[model samples]
Target: MRNRILILLATIAIYSCQDKQKTEQDNIIKTIAEDTLSKTVAGTADVSDASPTEDKAVELIRKQLNVLLKKDLPAMTKEDRFFYYEAFDLNNDKKNEYFVGFSNSYFCGSGGCSGYILNNDGTLINSFTVTDFPILVTTSSTEKFYDLIFETGGKFHLIKMKNGKYPSNPSVQEIWKGETPKDNAKVLDIDGKKLEKYSF
Candidate 1:
């Protein structure tokens, strides 16, 4: 009888230890699951909070363009009647800023178009010009200190904000001249030296 009792006690001890181990394992899993759930909830909250500001910025840009279009159409030819806004990290602030460009029927020279940077409040920050109509605009880390390239006039024009203003020195070198080739897009240094060329 005593032997049976001893066996039963040993069995109980082993069972108790197994139950404790199972409970600990379950607790660890639960903790991991809760942490993952928390991260997901936080990520979703961040996106939801960010979406409204993004939407508002887009809406403001659209309104500004609409006003410009309505007011400037009378001054623009049919071919010169377009304006566009681009978003980029012009100052490397990590927040996107605006570059507004417009075609002016009034400008007669090769650089007939103008551009401006817009503040977050939709106000014009500075006025700048390009050598021609901009077919495209992009950013690169190679030229501009912040790695921004304003592709216009058959070349990439490095633009940056200096002294709380856009670079106003009109004495900068004209990187490219003549006409853009149909097959190759060329880049040049500020001294008019060729850098690289690639097919569009």
Candidate 2:
């Protein structure tokens, strides 16, 4: 009888362990699936093709920007080149506006970068050179802000200005500065504004 009781207890223990292991595995898989789904959704929502009126303008602007980068910053490798062209409702306006960003590499890499805002009619509104690696680019009423939260060699920086201010002087003081780690940087928001160092 004692032998049978011992055998039953062992079986129960084994089953309990197996159940716990399965639960853990399920949790891990669930987390991974959630993350992947989030990324896919975010990417899809952010991508926008140029409209009929802006299609030609986007191509022209892209061509011009590519030429400028190739001529001026020849050190950028082909793989490092990236262009983010999208249309969104900037400034809470009913009409969608163009948002463009040219980068040499990821936010932490070396390269020259520029951001542009275009009117809904495809006219140039404003453009500026962002001296830092911009991880995220966004716009608002009266100003467009580029968030350089994860850029390397410096902290976060925010570039902001009104439309038609292309080639405007960059105010370093207005940029958000923060102390970021060399490998892993933590992004912090202060008083609704990103705090980080700004370079011209």
On TM-score, the candidate that comes out on top is 1
| lDDT for position 91 in model 1 | 48
TM-score each candidate.
0.40, 0.38
- Top-lDDT structure, candidate number: 1
lDDT of 1 by residue, 1-200 (tens): 99999999999999999999999999999998888788787863222343576566656665665554566657666556444555555546677676655544553246445655677777666666554433223343333324234445446454454556655322263343444334432222212332111110
lDDT of each model, Cα atoms only? Answer: 0.52, 0.50
Off by over 4 Å in 2: 1-82, 104-111, 133-153, 162-171, 177-200
**Whole-model lDDT for model 1 versus the true structure?**
0.52
lDDT of 2 by residue, 88-199 (tens): 5554567766655544343222434556556666566666553443334332223443322323234444445435353332334254545432443222222123322111
- How far is each candidate from the true structure, as Cα RMSD in Å? 13.8, 14.6
- The CA-based lDDT of model 2 is what? 0.50
Q: What is the lDDT of residue 189 in candidate 2?
A: 21
